[model samples]
Target: MCGIVGAIAQRNIVPVLVEGLKRLEYRGYDSAGIAVLDTEIKRVRRVGRVAEMEAAANEINLTGRLGIGHTRWATHGGVTEPNAHPHVSGDLIAVVHNGIIENHDEKRQALQAKGYQFESQTDTEVIAHLIHSYYVQDRNLFSAVQKAVTELVGAYAIAVIAKDQPDVLACARMGCPLLIGLGDGEHFVASDVSAILSATRRVIFLEEGDVAELRRDQILILDKDRQKAERKIHVSDVSLASLELGPYSHFMQKEIHEQPKALSDTIEPLLEAGFVPELFGANAKELLSKVDGVLILACGTSYYAGSVARYWLESIASVPCQVEIASEYRYRDAVANPNWLVVTLSQSGETLDTMEALKYAKSLGHDKTLSICNVRESAIPRSSEMVFYTRAGAEIGVASTKAFTTQLLALFALTATLAKIKGRLSDTQEQSYLDALRHLPGSVQHALNLEPQIKIWADRFAPKEHALFLGRGVHYPIALEGALKLKEISYIHAEAYPAGELKHGPLALVDDNMPVVVIAPNDVLLEKVKSNMQEVRARGGELFVFADLDSHFSESEGVHVIRTPRHAGVLSPVVHAVPVQILAYHAALQRGTDVDKPRNLAKSVTVE
Candidate 1:
């Protein structure tokens, strides 16, 4: 969940490394550091934001043609300068790493027995010492990094630079992402492509167990077998402007307001050509036609999106669907069906638990795999048999906004395709659903216009410590997502339950001081949820209901009705996802919390 940036250029590399770290700050960090080979290995570290390190770095006037930088999210150590990255060993090797080194304790003791004193309480420190031990034996920075990676266990993406070898830089990754950026008379390494997008768009994505050595003129890569390998170079389409905040105060606000464009961009192609299995892949039709069930695997907000999809897949396609959290999917033994289609979802497509779960499912003879993700070149999509990308652009906020909505749109399209393939969807029904997809952008725009009123509610309800969200049928998952957003960004304790389950247990949590949120769309479950709302009001719990325009609800004593725009049937979740995001965004603002980067969270969960 950290960031790594490295460069070997003709000019001083300090500014470039700092700029790279700045771009990665949205990924989340508690400490930042940079190391450079200026005559000797010079380093600077701070326990706060990257700005703190930038100021500390400018004071020393560190200069070098080779450098590495890191923004660390504490895993094995506390948030202190000594535990920050760019861990040094004997003043020879400087290493910056992402992901966990699973066997650090054993290796740390071995190094200590050999008289190598550690300077930090990080698993990354062992990486630097392991490389130092090999460097002294062979005196080759590239060879030392290659040997050290094989001796280590668990997932990691690392960049290394040596004091003796100032012109060369080395990097390797296993179960984590790393890429090489090619520039004129320069080369770079970064965990994310956006870090080096300003420097060069020409990049190479390293595969599992691939190691690379970058120099000023040439780049060399070796395969898992230690043989020379050839990898394709890709030109990225991510613009520098996408990474900027532009006129918005925070990235969550910008991304929340950008949902209309993001939703339209994601489903534009499907809207033009209509739903077809060939849109996903050439063989999608043949394989999907034979599948009997669907198994969805994801984590966090993506998992909630899958939860919404479960309702669609079962009703539309007449298929049994099961959604599992990726972290626990492989640990339990269940009936594995060969005819079940396994679908994996992720925004970064590099979630460690999801990737390992996908691999585990494949090992158990589930061959029909499809990936829905934002990054087209990410590891999960590359490992899957077929892939669909959501055009949400760059979601920099640690609390996801646009990515969750776009995933709902894509999952809806899949439901339609499966329904048509199974003969459950008639021609007229298909056209009606497609028409709703066409007007979804306008509906979401209408929802975003209610932000002023939503903010007012946020300010009034910001003082509460506990909240309850209620929804039924398809909207139950949306309520769960609402609770997650509030707790993660606003730091307010919130829980969600189906409207019918309130009498069983959650009813006791309701009191005069508690605020209960209700998601009531004009569907079959609207009457049942209204009864649930009254039960809350009867117990002195204030009601904040997000109702459709036609629902005919008014603001009365202890009840607040926020009228939402008219939404298409079955597409209501995509529209309802907006206000909850706005509620959480403004609530965090009222609480004086970091709205973009929350505590103990990162944009990409690259480590388990």
Candidate 2:
């Protein structure tokens, strides 16, 4: 995904766009660029982080009342200054785009035939020229945008500004997120609400195929047919304080500590109703009665949650489930049985791959699609048959912690509900699982208490450039997530292997300098994990264990243990995940890496 910000105001809007781009940098940060239409014109772009873009802007006079900015996650071209966003046409039509143009080859060829030269090898550059082409024919900015967008086929949330129309901004979206913020004597457009949270809280989420004309004091939305449409202004409750790290050193650390509250918020309603009625709503029992199998599509942390969810579905609901990375899942010629329920998970609710996968499934005549997301009115939730909201409340960190836990809790609740509906789990068994779920909040709190100790462990191990993570069964995915977090923010080379796979090939990498983190929670696989730990210890590798406090585990010379509260095997991963996240955060902070905005990584993968 790419982050886009545009503003039109009575006063200079370059500063507002710059600040908004900084806040939205978590979305994408491979390259950053901004176009400001001042007295004549100004464009500043760089092939690095936002800091470099800011430095370049200082060397140029970038003062304007109309501006558009972008932080890019490269897709169509390599990460270079020329491929960076805020693509400008020769006629001063500058655009900041966030999605892909699927038919760019044909469109670019046609534009080339028309003698419209191109600069960057990006699908997005075609839009600039197409808009310019249409504007030349129609002599109207909004009409040209509408005509150009109608001719283009694919997902996009584009904001375009012409030097001729410096006081007006044209924006449109299709299968991607865009928001318009209302402010006094100013108007704003961004890919998400976070960009404009500092400037205004009142926002209007633009729908798919909707075009908006933003002026200094007004925003008008129009449908594909050019008819004026009404949009509701939603007041966001996200305060500036929630976005700040406060006492924590980084956003990842703050988010790691927020897992307890996040889980409680997502689980309390299900616990009170004794079932997952909210996920299915009017057809809760009916939908479960007809379901035969499940397919989970997700990416990154959400994918790990799906892996854990598959175990829960098999154990609790007795449903055969498969988890797939959304990007690959959509391209394969896979069969979707009519009885299979497809569930997609995303924290942003605008993940491009996952949303496209769901659409592809739906296009194959699958009517039962469910989405679990944090945003209330995001594209994924709006497209699904049912939606489960995760109340994690603004996970700003690129590496997710609270979102993963809440997604697991949501899927676990769904599994329990399916079991209760299918008559698979006995009353005692259901109550036992329910009781454990009820006590999860306290268990999570206890796990959070281990943060200080984990920070100490991090300080000891932060000097190491590489690490290894190991686990078995459900904890296997937990270990993978842990390793991913470590590598994502800390810039440490880490690999997660199934405990049994250690002897296969990974054992060759273990040494005295290697730090191994094991998910050794007491479960049926506890002995197996311990065996793996012993194998590593015997090889002189430093070991860090997150074990159940009541388990028969004792401290060894090379082993460091962060004890977790005792819980059932089904919920141990949820409890054990907290320490690993904190460990990564602390390690990243110790290494002086940007924990909130990692390199070459975006919060949402909106462009495949």
Candidate 3:
């Protein structure tokens, strides 16, 4: 996933573009670059963070009222200066793109035949040449971008500027996200709202095949057919303060401590006395009552949240549920039931694999599509029939913390709503669940208080090369997420298994050097997982466990126990997630790795 920010204003926009790209740094990028429409097309690029590009840009002193910037996460090219974005064509046209061009090879060959020289190995370079080819013919920047997008075969969110039209900028998007920010005598476009939030909160979300022309005085929007179109302007509620780290060392650590507030924000609406299923949508109750089962599709941390939801749906709602990784969902010929309620979970809502999977699932005749998304105006939410927006605010950390917990809360609420609609839950039972939801914020905060003890485990785990995480039942998914968080930032090889499955294979991997983490909540599975922990201890493996106070587990020769807060029946997964996140955060901090931007990973996977 790459970041793109463009602005057309009456004053010099170089500072605006750079600042915007800085805000988008959390999206994950390998290189940074910018292009300004001065007397000539001035460009600066570097194979590092936005700060490097900013320093390099200041030296050039490029001045212009219209400009575009990009933070590239390399797709088809290596990390080098030549592969950085803000790619130029001829002498005037400059383009910055996000997402992949599936037919770049074919298009590149066609351009080569026309004597067009390529600069980099990136698929985005083909777009600069393609747009320039169209611009030379019509000499109209808007028409050039519109025609060039029609020739493409894959996802792209692009911004283009020409030296000839210094006052004009054009942008278009399909399959990836792009939006416009309305300002006084100015306009801005970016792949995400966080990039331009400081300048304007009034945003116009672009659809799958929308193109926008941004001029200093007027802005024009067009659809795929080139017809004039209109999109609603939304005033975002995310405050600028939410994007900053006031007292934390890194954003990951800040977000780890923000979980309690984030959980409260997410569950506040559903905790009301008379809350109903219509909170999701008017037809939510009717459709959920008729559905025979649930099918959940997601990727990465969101998939783990869905995994937890599978247990909740079957146990609490008494509905059959299945969870599939979005990337492999379409490749397999899985059975799609028309009566199954399809739920798609995503934080950015622009995950390309998840979006394509949602489309493919729809084509197979399933109409009951619902999206649990963070951004309400994002592509996946727009395509779905109904939506549940997660109020986690802006999560800037590449290693997700608050977003994951909020997703679990949202899915849990969905389970309670479905259970009430299906007559499995009485009014009193539902109220009891709501009461737990209301108290979950404090429970999360109580878990957060264990950070000092969790950090001690991280200190010991930082030097280990291998680890094993164990959980069972609903907590199995939480264990998986714990393993993912550790490996994502700390780079330690880790794996997770259901405690029962230890004897099947993972037991042999246990040794003196391996750190085995146990998520031993005070549920029925506690005794079973205790047995699994004994297998590890019997083999000389070190045990670091987060257990409930009443579980009666104590520290021993090889076992290090960190007693967690009170047991939270079904909602224990959300509460238990805190220590896992804290462990990963401090471990990565101990290892001196880039905790916020891990190696070879992007925060949002906008491309398959």
Q: List per-prediction Cα lDDT, in the order shown.
A: 0.92, 0.88, 0.90
Candidate 1, residues 438-532, lDDT tens digits: the string is 89999999999999999999997689888898999999999999999999999999999999999999999999988999999988988899899
**Model 1 TM-score (2 dp):** 0.99
Worst 10 residues of 2 by lDDT: 276-285
What is the lDDT for 444 in model 1? 92
lDDT of 2: 0.88
Pick the winner on TM-score between candidates 2 and 3.
Answer: 3
Per-residue C-alpha lDDT of model 2 across residues 1-608, encoded as one tens digit per residue: 78999998888787788888888888888899999887545789998788889888877756888889999998888999999989988756999998899999999999999998989989999999999998877567888899899988988999999878877799999978999999999999999888899889999988879998998877789987789999888998777877877898778778888887888888777777787555566765566678899999999899999999999899778899999999998999988887988999999999989988998998887888889999878889888888888889988889999999999888988888888878887879878887888889899999999878999999976899999999999899999999999999999999999999999999999999999999988788888888888899888988998889878888889998888888555888899888899899889989988888887787887777
Top-down lDDT ranking: 1, 3, 2
TM-score of each: 0.99, 0.93, 0.99
What candidate 2 gets wrong by more than 4 Å, as runs, is 47-62, 77-80, 216-218, 224-228, 426-431
lDDT of 3 at 255: 89
Best lDDT among the predictions, by candidate number: 1
